[model samples]
Target: MDATPVAPPTRAADARLDRIPVVTRSHRIWVALLGIFFTFDLVDLNTFAYVAPALRSEWGLSITAVGAVTSVSFLGMFLGGLLGGRLADRFGRRPTILGSAVFYSTFSLLSAVSVNVEMLAVTRVLTGFGLQAMTGVLLVYVTEMFPREQRGRYQSLTLALGLLGVPIAAAVSRLLVPIGPGTWRWVFVIGAGGIVGVILSVRLLPESIRWQVAQGRAEEAEPVLAKLESEARGILGRDLPEPGPAVETAESGNIRELLRPPYLQRLTVASAVMICLILGFYGFSSWIPTLLVEDGYTQTESLNYSLVLAIGAVPGALLAWPLVDRFERKTLILGISLVVTVLLLAFGISSGAVLVMVIGFLINMLMQMLVAVLYTYLPEVFPTRLRGLGAGCANSVGRLSGAAGAFIVGGVYSGLGYTAVFLYLALVILLLGTLLALFGERTTRRRLEDVGSAPEPA
Candidate 1:
């Protein structure tokens, strides 16, 4: 009789053999560190908004000029997300992250030294290139680090913590704006500090084991997985299941994959949501202090009201953590969109400071929450093979839309009035909500694989 042929070792079995359970403690620590990094990133990105009035006064900037300064960053961000996503896939998440961090930090420091509006615009563009890379890479990292069950909650929490920078920037800007003759420059200087710290801390972080395995670098991934497993067991008081074998289905780093069929749809929905959200957010927020100033409040009072509005975002971020995983992603998005639309209209129509503040608080809460949800939901819709690319494309599209929105709002607010501009924003938000309800997929409590695969029949 002929000798029986042996079958090849299965990928799943091979993965099981190489599996290492990660420690919860280490995971939590890493998550906390990432959150800190995000805070600085937010501060760096948003400080320009808070300091806009000061910059305008000193530079004699027109509405269009101010809009150009703000929108230029988004232009860079648009390209960065597209390029960085592909780079992360090809080069690995760690290198792309490190590179972007260094780039942003260096440019942000240089921004403080800007001598003219032209130089400032250039620096802002460079800073945005780096800043945008962080978002896609960070989302990929978070998804791979946590297990499927807790992915939504953990992502939501991290996002919420990161958003703390919004209020922090607002508060710090208020403090610094009043102190020195050139206080706005100090805000940029302080923002640069956060990026530097992140760059240093990231050195101690490990590369993603999933990415390693996917690249068929099992030998290299072993030690990292072992460390993770040991740490997880220590925290959970039990050994966790080892990750499955490295299945290299397709190259993850290629940007072209995003243009393919199902992925194209996912990209479209995500980009649309981003455009709507940012338009609503920046349209109202960029002019918050100006609005207050127009309503007869002193500069001090305007800044104070803006501070109050910023503070309200903290609880909003916190509240979003649990709900993100519990409800359908699209539903949460739609609900927030509706709430914000109504609140924006209310805010525009009202004259009383107290009433405006109340509406502003509600609007801020919903906007912050929507951001967290969008970040968490968008990535979940793409497979690991193209997670970075999908995220990058969506983010890039959103940034482009945001840039347009900024320009449009600046022109409209300058030419028309605040009420008309806000009413227009309300209509945009309502339209976006409708689109989400009609086209957005439900992703709550589902595994990333489930969402990332081809869509099911209607």
Candidate 2:
């Protein structure tokens, strides 16, 4: 038999993947498809808040019970983030995304059929698990998709499209929940339609080529790379640039590695940021409608107010898209967090409806900006080998904290009211923002391979 000549390793795959221009037809399609999935995910996530007042009225549930229901969902999301990240690393991002969509959509359908609060809570938790884990995976995929130079811009655009679903959900709830008895079930029923995401993900999204190269699955990565290269060459009307040096990467990702050295610091800072951000987020966003209802505003009035507030999310995400790449991620995050604190405080203290609407609009805008910037920035700090795991674990911490914060808000609101909740959130945002400002890794405009290849901290 003739001797077979060995081909040199194609370890430069990450560099090649990174070298593609950020603007291409395929990239736009990916953004649109993923943005659609994210839109549905946000709709499902915000469903609980919209349904809560209805549940309280229909089930005669206490404030604590409503909080518990929300908490259970967060608990599920926490577990999902942990498991989903590991699974994505082991299996693939495409499959994980598909699985999460189906899992959450199925549970959301079941939640609609629940006969009582207990059943609803359990179903919502299951739905939340899939929804949240999917979110973590989605962020990982998105980070790996675009070149670092435009990652923020595209991610922000995707988020803007997705956040529009919040207003959609709020509007839907405004229309549906007020219709008749037991109409709240329709909110969840609508969320169950996220099954469409599974179909789109399977048919449209490709596996992360960067992930394939990092895993040393060069054979599997070839076709994906070819398609990307072809697209890039066609757009440039010439040959592709030679890729930079291959990144040195771990053979595989594991949680233990994340606990040590460079990753450990990123994990610590990311977790703190995630926790405080979610606490502040849920404190205001998730609790606002309930707080309004509790304060004697009618359910319709509360949802109407929330709907108006939700409208600002789209514009907020849009505002962040351009600036996301213009400024350092941490600097933008810190500045936005400070603005959010001021607006949150303003919203809490002001009693005039006109003032409230203005402040609420500003707050929602800043919150969406915060969300877009963080999503763009967090996954960049981890190596492709451990990106999913690191992002998942850190995000799960936020979910866990959110689970607890839900109950705390319930108790605090029941005792001290919205002002206290808003003030506490302000303090939390300040501390966490400062921590991130001090410790965050700078990844703006750097190659993923370069950013992820640095040595451990001393």
Candidate 3:
């Protein structure tokens, strides 16, 4: 008889069988660091809006110019998300993250020195490119670190923690605007400080062993995995199993891969949900303070109202943490969409200031819940290799929709009136709810591969 030849184990086969030990402490620490980084990114993105009144008054900027400044960064984010994912796939997650931090930090500092709208716009665009790239890589890093069963909970928690930046930014803006001559500039300075913390912490963190293994550098991955395993044993008080092999489904990280059969359908649903969510979120959020001011509130009163709105988001985010893992993601999304739609319409039609504040709080709450659900859903629907690329693309598309929302609300607020603009927002939310109810897949209790495989025909 002829001797039988043995074949090498494929990456997918190795990943399917191997079970890495879980170290909760190290995982939590890493998640905290990433969350802090994301917080800074959010601060940088929204700080401009918080300081918009000051900037417009100082520069005599038209409403169109203010909208343009906000939209420019989002346009850069759209491009960054697409390119950044592919770069992370090629160069490794750690490098992409660090590079983005350095790039955005530098540009944020530059924004403080801008003398004209053109210069400010350019700096924001560059800052946005780096900010979005870091965000894309961080999502992949967080998702890959956890097991499929705990992915939703982990993602939701981190997202909630990251959103703490919203209130922090708004608070800082309110406090500084009264004391400083260039308070908006100071906001950018604070954002720069946050990036410095990220740069230092990220250096001490380990690269993803799964990513290393996928690149066929198993020997390099071994030491990292061994260290992680040792940490796990310390926490769990038992020896842990080895991690399974890394899987590589596709070599190309191009946009074309997202359009391939299974991914295309998932992408479409994710994009639609994202677009509608942003329309609802930005429609009210971007104009909340202005609306309050128009309703006879002082600047101080408007700022306080905005703070209240930001505070409401904290509970919404926390509520999602446990339920994200417990319920169907689609159901959560659909439920929040309906709640937000109703609250926003009620807010628009109501006449009492106290009632408006109460309704605004609820709207903020449900919007944050919708966002938590979305972050959990998008990443869970893609394989480890494609997670960053797919999620980034979906997020980028959503950012574009949000930019449109800013323009639409700003344009119509003068001509169509605030009530009309809000009704239009309500209509968008209704359509989004319907789409999610009908097309969104149930992802709770399912593995990433299973979720990815459940996509319908494109």
Candidate 4:
């Protein structure tokens, strides 16, 4: 079903990959390994937020200071997005993925040994960088390797696996952070568990076959392709389907192609969507526990509340699996954005514990659905040669806003109070919905080459 490009990349080759009915066993192993890697990505990403109360009591961190640390780490994510995308574009997705796992895991371990806020902030910056870098490339890898029709949901499936990290963070923060002094260190130690993922990835993951042919390294793609074909054959209990009809040979292009006509439009739309989404999503999620404490809830009560809300993440992603394949991705994102806006407004105004929990859970579910769909869509908008770079460009710019969001939300919460901050988040998602409605392009179930191609004349 997949292949090494024996000649230059051909329509025949792309057809072989596109028509594969199921993931081969060889490739499923990689998917499981990648799921482990991203699960840890979520763990390291949220560790700081979950442990904020402990940091406040033990190290005297104020909300303003938490904002500072959060902003700086997001800035690191901004850089990592750019750097990782470029690396993946040039060096290939496999190495970039493996290399970034090492980069982040090392820094996540370093987080456990931080002596003070400054030390923690420094470690967090590097950790954030590696996490984003790893993330951008992984999404690109999925875009290239997975079946075209099923790509969107597969993206969500991996994310659903990764979202397990949310509950992991919640449980550890609740159970371990309360055990007196220095216990929060145990949470960071667990965050460093990406090292285990990296080891598994080294053994189980294959170099991306599509990326190889895109770079004209057909020979290198052969062995991996053979193993995948064998597995796929066994699963089918017969010979593979004949390759589909070939279209024109799709010429590969680089990042400059995105700076030109069709992709530039898509890039702008994606960046706008991501910026607003980051503000709304991160504005709420990044500040939840800390804000609960600020509202006069005890740390223990806040963690209990957070743990309940974190459980929503898995269902949120799972809920999208069918829909992601069923609808146009852009339309789905716009619809979810509208729904999240309404829920956020309710979250802002509610006071009773039951009402608040219900609203929060819905918001978490819809937001994950939005995120899973959006990640699937991002890589689809660009050509394979520069897919990583293009997605990273938009993603990094959005992350820059994500950094700003910590400060913006913190300042708004400090000056105007909690309800006003949620109001602001409502406005942000509303803006996101408007942008998608206006400029978002459709990418559902299209070939990567065709999806990224310039429009045909009417």
Best by TM-score: 2
**lDDT of every model, 2 decimals:** 0.75, 0.85, 0.73, 0.84
> Per-residue CA lDDT of candidate 1, range 154-237, in tens?
777877777888889889989988775577887787666555546566666677655665565645655555455555556666
RMSD of each candidate relative to the true structure: 5.2, 3.7, 5.0, 2.7
Q: Cα lDDT of model 1 overall?
A: 0.75
Tell how far residue 57 is off in model 2, in angstroms: 0.8
* Of candidates 3 and 1, the better by lDDT: 1
Off by over 4 Å in 3: 1-23, 233-252, 453-458
Backbone clashes in model 4, listed as residue pairs: none
Residue-level error in angstroms, candidate 3, position 79 = 1.2
Q: Which lDDT tens digits does candidate 2 get at residues 1-458?
A: 21222223454777777678747777888888888888889999999999888888888989889889989999999999999999999888989988899999999989989999899889989999999889998889889978778889898998888887899889999999999788888888878766876777677788988788777786687766667677767777766666777774538888898999889999999999999989988888899999887777888889989999999999898888878899889988999988888887877788866787788878988888888999998898899889999999999999999989998888777689778888888888887678888999887887876677695234
Candidate 3 lDDT over 352-391, as tens digits, reads 7688779888888878787777777777677656667888
Please provide TM-scores, in order, for all candidate models, with all chains considered together.
Answer: 0.90, 0.96, 0.89, 0.94
- Model 1, residue 230: distance off in Å is 3.5
Best by lDDT: 2
